[model samples]
Target: MSALWDLPDYDDHEVVHFVRDHASGLSAIIALHSTHLGPAAGGTRFWHYADKTNAVKDVLRLSRGMSYKNAMAGLPMGGGKAVILADEDRTKTPAMLAAFGDAVERLGGRYVTAEDVGISVADMQAVAERTSFVSGLPAEGDNAGGDPGPFTAFGIFLGIQAAAKFKLGRDSMDGVHVAIQGTGSVGGRLARLLAKDGAKLTLADIDADGANDLASELGAEIVSTDEIMQVECDVFSPNALGGVLDDASIAALRSPIVAGGANNQLARPEHGKLLAQREILYAPDYVINAGGIISVASEYFAKTENREVDVAEVRERIAEIPGRLVSIWEEAASSGRTSAEIADARAQELIGRG
Candidate 1:
């Protein structure tokens, strides 16, 4: 109740752990939620959470959300997440990542790790030095070390189109106004895609320079991070950290559709109901941001080539967002439930059979 991960009502199977050094340096957290489907798999974020308990809660909730996301995305993988507490200084040692790899190894393939947050492609390579349980690196090429955020943005772009079609009764992104908060890897690329599609863009980020750069590049207007939720736009995309849509902020949000690449965007389960009450077409963050998972999962199992990531196929999958959102919206309306409740019900129904 106090934390986003501490949802007492959900029947979740979660395992939370803290581990010390693996090779030399690293504080690691592994959260596994395996009962939802199969072995848990998620990303390793290397940022310093304000509180250790918050980090634990984030990993736990993110892992379970991953289970639901993977299930909804029709992936065979379960859900898990790793958070490595780091100082503000990112120029640490490879030993930290190696230690995280050891944590992954301790799971014996039941829990796999990739990259997220403060983790990067280079960090994955460091983890790979100790274990083979990591993914998201492009194959041998000049662009081999590219981040998966662009792909994620691409998928979200497609999903936004799907959302518009289903919720707004529009067919194209020609004049859609989108407010993207946090112009980081995913949000920056999302801004680019929206600009290319002739969509009006309003960008925001804690890093003013980063946001301004992207805004200038994409011809988007810039907004402050604090003003993002209140921006009058067709869609609101949160690409920053989790739990941004708390009660205080939710009341100020003026967007018609809310979707993005952020994990755990909802501050609480009740926020979903708040959105429903406001008639905001909210796409579940987990459901919309499955591209990175799909990419990494393919790498873990099939060793699929990056070029093989068919944009059309990915777009087709993302285009199903509207159908899924519509179903969840309808179910919520009929049952007087939240979209999250409907989504969790559908996910549990699928995983319960397995």
Candidate 2:
């Protein structure tokens, strides 16, 4: 049971490549979950984990999620993910980037990586110095490129709108209450978007200063991290890390709808059933969070083909996210299944794994 295949999150990943560069103090894992549609494409996450096993477990799950994400987004790519184990201090160096890029290059186009949590366009610049397989490169005006945060936030906002309409019968965010966890890139932007529509917001983050500043800017209320989920609100959006919507969390949720940009929101598949039992309208994370990958994939494909990436086209694809969510929600309602289950089944069919 200690073996890689025995890991609960493994899911028969096609490749799990480990890289170690002692000179650069680099240790990384790249996992490919599928290639049925095309080469595996996902982002590289540079995070500090407690141990190697946890890191591997994270990559395995993330890679599989990416596969589902890409498939659900109707992209011609499979899923893969890379993780660089950072030191406790989270120190990053150019040498480490170069070594990681080299590792990606060794895969020979089997994997494509862009920015994820803790990674940035500047860091991807360093990685691109060693490999052309990187995405999120800076583009000219009105092109599909650069950081994906705004695009992701936009999609989440749209999905929230859809969820609100489907679940709460509200046509607008006006006076709607949203309790948001993690007021970082996606969450903060989403809060601003909702505020523009007159949403009453309650925000929380581990980084108190940033969250406080954002709350001040939007004239929204702020709360503690430990209490965001149980807040009495119309929507509970988790824009932080994954695995927060487990059994106990679902039981404690006070919101009628759960929709956010976080990946793998359900800790396990069974938790989706728990949400259904509670009648909490769930937005499957992969479907709701595909905006980032949509931007990344559009940019990546355009870069490889020596063509100008159409910004409008990318936005058009991103706008489809809400419809997909609504489809799953309605289907689940009529079919007696969870939104997560419906989304997963659709993704599995797309990836040739159903």
Candidate 3:
């Protein structure tokens, strides 16, 4: 176990390096935290962690977040995350995925993995080749898999609307200028949906071409990723990674609403209060981004049980975010607590029960 994982509250740990000699690559590092709720479940993030320590920190924090996310989202699962560090020259191949599949099988469903950053549907398919534990598989019913990005974006979008209504008394997204801080798969899909609802978009990404392409396709303007924080827009959607809104970024924020699909969007809990004071309607990241988990949860349990996930049911359930956000905002105002605290309380209560 890493020294950092020894933090007083966290109670469990597991790490595996799925190496493929044929592909000369490492496939994944799976982490599970089961005691918090039930089995650990989270997406597979494919990126280069600076070291084993950093990777451990990410997987630990992420798995813990998944526990809270599921509890808050009203699901029966706990939290877990898988990471695949790519060497580019040494790894990333079908054989590597097969190796990852073996690693997942070894867990015996104590942790479940799905699609996330740096991973694709094909990768999940490869993982699926090794374990029945994998979700986001082919259309077992009305649910099909290419990626869960759009569905996640929809949940965030609805949560944003909820934030807007709670903070601004607005019911529609019409004419809302939204500055998106990362126009990748999830962010791009979110931009399109918001655009469809008549929200103007100012988009940014490290991939200039990808950003520009999405901007052009959506009739939106492109900005440098850094500029997104200071854009004079109604909503600032940090659709990238965690810690984007730290003391530095929070001090520079110009929007009244901050919402998106990024996990752990706030550098720390106090940032939520900074938003509250700035009158910025900050949607809790885990609460808003629960769509992918909800989808995959259905796949994990429903598909195997041969039960159908009614599309309307899932969509309707997603729409509930706005109402929940509205209530949380009101509660925060009345109690003088950060909305995230309120949210964390809810998650804690749920997890505490089990």
Candidate 4:
């Protein structure tokens, strides 16, 4: 790989710490994009990468997205993310979690760690044993801190409704057909919420059995992972991973709108322009997925201050997601710039990068 600064995803990052604890086979990278809003806050993703450079790229892009996500969501937090390199079997261990926690603790509270991709609440609990700067612990009764997947799904659900109103002239998802491309935590919950709205659904996931089970519950159709993107639907929600909206994929989309909990949906900056050229309404991923970080930040801050978390407040903040998307869409319509560009500029301004 080139110098860290030369990486395309590197965006004037404040800090990038490469951590290794050979004793536990722990190797990770933590990237901090900004702290203008507050302490850099985001989740730690655990995944096995065939090419480790992709891991670097992921932390860089994801940390920056978290910065944008938090700023746009009006949170008093900046952006930071960590990626723990796993082996082919995706092995994880307590010692590794402890080492990672020690790494975060050494940051002197500049970085707050939580759960992401392969990391779980139990994993985070283990990490918290070594660091005070952690969140996503199981909720105290009636509190706002826990797995953020449902919250993220709720936000995406609302944002999709907003897009339908703005682009399809539909107030609700009553009869809308939405093709969802992941049956895991966020995507599955999103499917459930959309189902409650009486939407027609077609679902796909790398885990075929899981997808089939979810489809059974919702009376939805199941498609192969290869076919989900090309399904003729009003919305194509990519909730699995990023870089799915590259040139060829965007060219193949049949949906009028693309929105989901996936981060960095655009493979490159130009892809946003391509979406615009195709006249597809793209819901900037970070804005729609801010729900997770919102819950994490609230829990962390509330714990630090010895105060109770307000569940209603968290939902109220998530409720604003649709309005933000509407504003971005409106600006894109009026200025001829892509929604992604407008959202980036707005986030940059908020982080004092303007």
Misplaced by over 4 Å in model 1 are 1-14, 140-146, 304-319, 333-335
Q: Pick the candidate with the highest lDDT.
A: 4
- Model 3 error, position 233 (Å): 1.1
lDDT of each: 0.77, 0.92, 0.78, 0.95
- What is candidate 4's lDDT per residue for 144-255, written digit by digit as tens? 8999888899999999999889999998899999999998999999999999999999999999999999999999999999999999999999999899999999999999
Worst 10 residues of 2 by lDDT: 302-311
**Cα deviation of 77, candidate 1, in Å:** 0.6
Tens-place lDDT per residue, model 1, 1-354, is 364345552335567777887456677778787645667888888777667666667777787788888888787888788888886675568666677777788777788777788888888888888777777765544322236676678778877887787778889898999999888888888888889999999999999998898888888999888788899999998988988888888789888889888888988788998888888888888777877776666556645332444434544555565567677777776888887777878887777733
Over 305-348, each residue of candidate 2 has an lDDT whose tens digit, in order, gives: 88877879988999999999988988998999889889989999
Tens-place lDDT per residue, model 3, 1-354, is: 535547533445544333334453564567675546666789888887656566666776787788888887777888888887776453477777887888788778788888989888888998898887787766644653446776788898888777767667778989888899888888988998899998889999999999998899899999997688998888889898887888888888888888888988877678888877777777788888988788788667776677667555677767777777777778888998888888888876787743
TM-scores of all candidate predictions against the true structure: 0.90, 0.98, 0.92, 0.99
Which residue runs does candidate 2 get wrong by more than 4 Å?
none
Give the clashing residue pairs of candidate 2, or none. none
Give me the runs in candidate 4 sitting further than 4 Å from their true place.
Answer: none
RMSD of 4: 0.7
TM-score of candidate 2 versus the correct structure, residues matched by position: 0.98
